[model samples]
Target chain A: MTPIELRCCGQGGQGVIMTGMVVGKAAAIYEDRHATLVQSFGPEARGSTCSAQVMISDAPVPFPYVRHADILVAFSQSAYDKFVAELKPGATLIYESDLLSLDNRLPQGVVARGIGATRIATEVLGRRIVTNMVMLGFLVKQTGIVSKEAAIEALRTLVPPGTSAFNIKAFETGYQQPPE
Target chain B: MTKREAQPLRTGLHFMNGNEACAEGAIAAGCRFVAGYPITPSTEVVEHLARRFPRIGGMFIQMEDEIASSICFQGAVWAGHKAMTVTSGPGLSLMMEHIGFAAMTETPSVFINVQRAGPSTGLPTAAAQGDIMQVRWGSHGDYAIIALCPSSPQECFDLTIEAFNLAERYRCPTFLMMDETVGHMMGKVRIPDAADLTVEPRRNTTRAPGDYQPYATYDGSDVPEMTRAGDGHAIHVTGLTHNEKGYPDMSFAVHDALVRRLQRKVHTHTSELFRLEADGLDDADVVVVAFGITAGIAAYAVTQARALGRRVGLLRLITLWPFDEARIRTLTANARAVIVAEMNLGQVCLQVSRAVQGRIPVHHIGNPGGPVIEPEEILAAIEGAAT
Candidate 1:
């Protein structure tokens, strides 16, 4: 892909930054491409809005900030509301269907899909904390920005050692979900 | 010894942020002492060092304040250890006095200033290149310093090693001027085996106790060989103007010689320390000059400007200090204008203007601090400068 900018936004404790890091690592380390991730958060430790911007490209990813996201994956209602307008026209947006409601204000010509990422993680994976992983899996599957094996390898390195198997299962489940 | 003689390093492609990579670079460079207090954007450098240093037989101290931290590393340096301190703008401001002290006593140490927005306590979470002048001139002195700016995580790792080498080579404080964006950005860093990297060892005096002069240069070299504080060499170090015997001379001749040597050491080595990445400069009408994170954005802007059939080039300053005045003069001589892009209110622009000597206009694209200067803004500046 020609330099694609991706942004993931959620609450502070929702692993937004980790998701961005994993995707960036998958492309940069495993896929032999270039990626840069920049994270932003506030003083509030747990519930504050947090976002991670990742740019993946065949060439060096300079200008690290996401000016207008080519792809946005948001996991909270507040995050979705805050960042939806920053999407480029005809950009792809993926949000948690169970956590966020779409408004009429999404930019024109935007292609958006919603997945019940939190629900799937809580019910199928038995852990709601891996919702970010599920969303990341869904993002990789839909966009094909990174290979599934590459994403799984990144998870193996990033996630806590003892819980890798469980997180990988959540990722696979989310990867199989049909986009809506 | 060269890097080829060191132990094997974790040499492979790894994904890490600039701060974490800096910690790894320090370890690979054989830096054993890190003293720093936690601050926004720069705290990760200490955090990673804290976790890694202990396992590798190094020491990481979270000092009570920036002042204590800055001096703490100098103490380690005197005791024969490679040392560094990490901080952001306000903390760097607090360490300025000690940085001067490091220069005065010829302490070989490194200071990693992951710059954020600030004169005092400005935006702690945002990126800024505002500390460019501060790192150079904040300390009260007529002394020169070696300051390196890294625009990526890989350079963060590579140049941290270079910072240590330069500090030891010149026996003065070296600055790694990073910004919030590069500090937090994650990317692939290919760390080679330690045996393959070039690491400079600290130069210690081989003179006998009676013959050693802590500030002496009997060999005519500007840098005196440093003897450890407790190395049985009757060495005395003080911030005051001292003679070759390391005793305070309080005389005009001694002070002039001491101060001039301190500045001359870095000045004479400008050819070795002044590093820049010049692209499209051989045939260009307008050139963009930038350092730190702004340099990365300027590169992209130069690419876009070139695509639009504009003869715009980029001169990315990896070494912000020592200015590279001769290269700047030659590059701007035939250009219509030069654009100095940075995250501050025209600090580097002043340097560019001085270097250009009014032969051409020097346009500045500056951001007070919050957001980065967009590539389009620089592209527009390139268009304006081209006209």
Candidate 2:
């Protein structure tokens, strides 16, 4: 792939930074590519909006910051609203359908798709915290930026021990969801 | 000691952030003592050290404040441990007195300053190269220091080991001046096995207990031999100007000779510590001098400028302190202009200007702190310098 800049944003406790870390590790460590991850350094502990920027490339990534995101993965209405303006024209946006109500006033030429990630995690996986991993599964299937094997391997190392099976099931459920 | 016996930590490829990589580098270099209070950006270094030190028979202490943290590491050094302290701008400010003390006593230690926006608690969450000058002159007096800047996570791991090696080799304090961006950013790092690394052992005095003079150099070397506190050597370490006995000597001659030796030890041996990355300097009309994060940006700008048929090159300073004057003078002597790009307001630019000495036009592109300098802005500077 050429260089791709992605931003995953959400509220403080929504695992936005962890999603970025998994994707970056998948690319840099497992896929034999280059990736750089930088997170927002704001007061994120107070449940404020936070983001993590991940840049993936076949070569070394020169700059770590995301000036304009090619792909934006938002998990909340506030995150989508705040970051919608920074997406490049014709950019792809993946968001949680249960959390965000899509507005018709999105930036011109932007392609947005929604998945009920939180619903799948809670109802099917019996956990609400696995929504980010569910979204990561959907992200891998939708964007094709990282291979499924690489993503799954990255998830194994990133998640807590003995819980990888549950998270992988949540991810597969999200990946099998139809586009809305 | 034999090279095989010096190996300490296992090495492998890992995806880690710069701060964690720095902590691993210290462990691989056999650093056994670390003391620091948590701060923004730099807190991860201490966090990683706290977790790993216990496993390796090392000590990690979260001191009450940066003042105590700074001196605590020096005390550990005197007790025959390779010591380090990690902090940000505010904590670095508080550690200045101890840094000066370390310099005066010729204490072998390392200080990792993950710089943030500041004059006084400025943007704590953002990155900045504002502490470049402070690391060189923040501590009072005329003593010289060794400072290294890393541009990437791999360099963060590699240069940190080099920082500890330089500290032990010279028996002086060394600074690993990293910025918030490089400290917190994540990238791929490949760590070589300890057997593949050349670790510098401390220059301990070989003389018998009664014959040892702590500050005396017997072999015409400027660097003095060190002895630990419990080594049965009658060593007296003081911040005051002392003679070869390591005691306070008030005479002007003693003070002059001592101070000169302290500065000369680093100054005369700068070639041993000098490190930089240069590109396209053979026939370039414009040169960009940058360090740390700005160097990565400037390097990209140089490549872009070259593609546009402009004769631009980059002089990235990996070692910042004993400022590479000889190389800078030679590289910029015949160039049309030189551009110094940093996050601070022309701090290193002043050094570049002095090195150029009216031989070429020196332009500065700087930000006070916070936001990073974009590559397009550096390209503009390169084009302008070409004109």
Candidate 3:
């Protein structure tokens, strides 16, 4: 299979790296594909921009960093602004509707989907940190790049103990949302 | 010394970073002591060790500086424990003197340098292969050391164990030369059962106390048997040129013998020390030689070049030191040209060029610092070399 590059980004506290880890594990460990995830490392504080670039392929990923993003999951306005231009033509954009206001000009042939990830996460799960998982669930449903079972299994293994069930609930809630 | 029961291995498939995998590798290799000063791109190694070592009957100390960290683990080694220390470029700089000390004392120890770009703290969070030469000749001395470059998290796990084994086998400072990218990249690593693993037991002397000498070569073995502190052997460990008894000897003859023996112990095992992976060099016109993260990128470029009907191949260096010049010469003997790609400004490229010996045009593709070299650039070099 051709390699697919996904850029998952948000502020540091939004579980951006964890989102990438879950997706990477799902594809690499569960789905029998090779995946490499390179997270942004630096003086990234809680409210600063943080990103995880993931590449999944049938063979081992040669280039660990994302060049042209096939899918972009933006959890904050700054993240969307920072990475939107790198999306490939005819690529998919999954963004948090409550956090990002879509710009007028996007790349040609782009398909964009926005979800109120933070709102649903806070209102339904009573935890804002689960927003990234909600966004991940929407991504899995929309792209089908990884199986639902694969994503759930990956989530169980990656997230901190005692919080997997709640995160899975958030994921399911996002997965069940209408495909408008 | 009695053989201890192996630490229970975390044997299974799991997703982890290179640093985390390295820490697990150390545990699997029976490295019971670690002293480290935390630094970016390498901090995770010690952090993981700190958390895991306490539960596994191991020790992890956060030393005040890299100088202390480097030598602290050697003390543990002398105390009959397999040991390691973790650091990055700046930390490695501070530990240079101790590295030479380890070399002189013939201490079996592992030094993990998760390299970032630097003459000095150039880019703490970014990756580079800058330390390639420094690691080889960093410490002041005429000595040979073994260094391994791991391309991914899996190799990071595998090579760390190899590092310890080689350290014990040769009684020298063995290095796991990792980069920031590999250290931070998350991938799947499969750790095997402890029983299936091949750990090199410490080469401890079995002779009675008074008859044993720390630096005496017995029979055909070039490396001498070691006795730990408190083992009732009157072993004198010193940085000075020592004789068979390991005491300070000022004579040039003694120094020459000691140094040659030290170098010969590793050089004689060059066949085993050399680890390489060569792909598609059978009838290739151009071969790309790379190590660490650059090898993966070069492989991708080789694939692209092959798709374009170019005769391109890739040779990855697994063990960086004890430079396998003969193998490199033999492998690329038929190729038209060679390309050396690395993140540094032509460190390994110089070595490759020397090995090629002006037989073929050795093209170098290098980046001074962060953000790895692009595959297109490497492919371009391959195509150019082929033409």
For model 2, residues B24-110, the per-residue Cα lDDT tens digits are 889888798999999987999999988777767888999999999999999999999889999999999999999899999999989
Every model's DockQ:
0.71, 0.66, 0.73
TM-score of each: 0.95, 0.94, 0.96
Over 4 Å off, model 3? A44-46, A103-105, B1-7
Best by TM-score: 3
Q: Which docking class does model 2 fall in?
A: medium
Among all windows of ten consecutive residues in candidate 1 chain B, which has the lowest summed lDDT?
B1-10
Put down candidate 3 lDDT per residue, B1-387, tens digits, no spaces: 333334558888878899999999999999989999999889999999888877778889999999999989999999999999999999999998998998889999899999998879798888999998998899897998999999999999999999999999998989999999999999878899888889999999999988888899885678889998998999888998998898898999999988988889898888778999999999989999999999988988898899999988899999999887888999999999999999988988898888889998998899887889999999888877777
Query: Which of 1 and 3 is the better model by lDDT?
Result: 3
Q: Any residue pairs clashing in model 1, and if so which? A: B3-B195
lDDT of 1 by residue, B1-387 (tens): 112323425689988999988988998898989999999889889999887776667889999999999999999999899999999999999998999999999999899999899878899888899988888898896888999999999999999999999999998889999998899888889899877899999889878998878888867779999888888998788899899888888999989988999999999988778999888987899989998888988988998899899998899999988786777898777788899999999998998898888888999999888888888999999988787
- Which clashing pairs does model 2 show? none
lDDT of 1 by residue, A56-151 (tens): 989887678887899999989999988998999989999989888998989999989889998888888889899988888899899887899999
Return the interface RMSD of the candidates, in order shown, one decimal each: 1.4, 1.4, 1.2
Angstrom error of the Cα, residue B170, model 1: value is 0.7
How do the candidates rank by TM-score, highest first?
3, 1, 2
Candidate 1 TM-score, C-alpha based: 0.95
How far out, in Å, is residue A67 in model 3?
2.8
The better candidate by DockQ, 2 or 3, is: 3
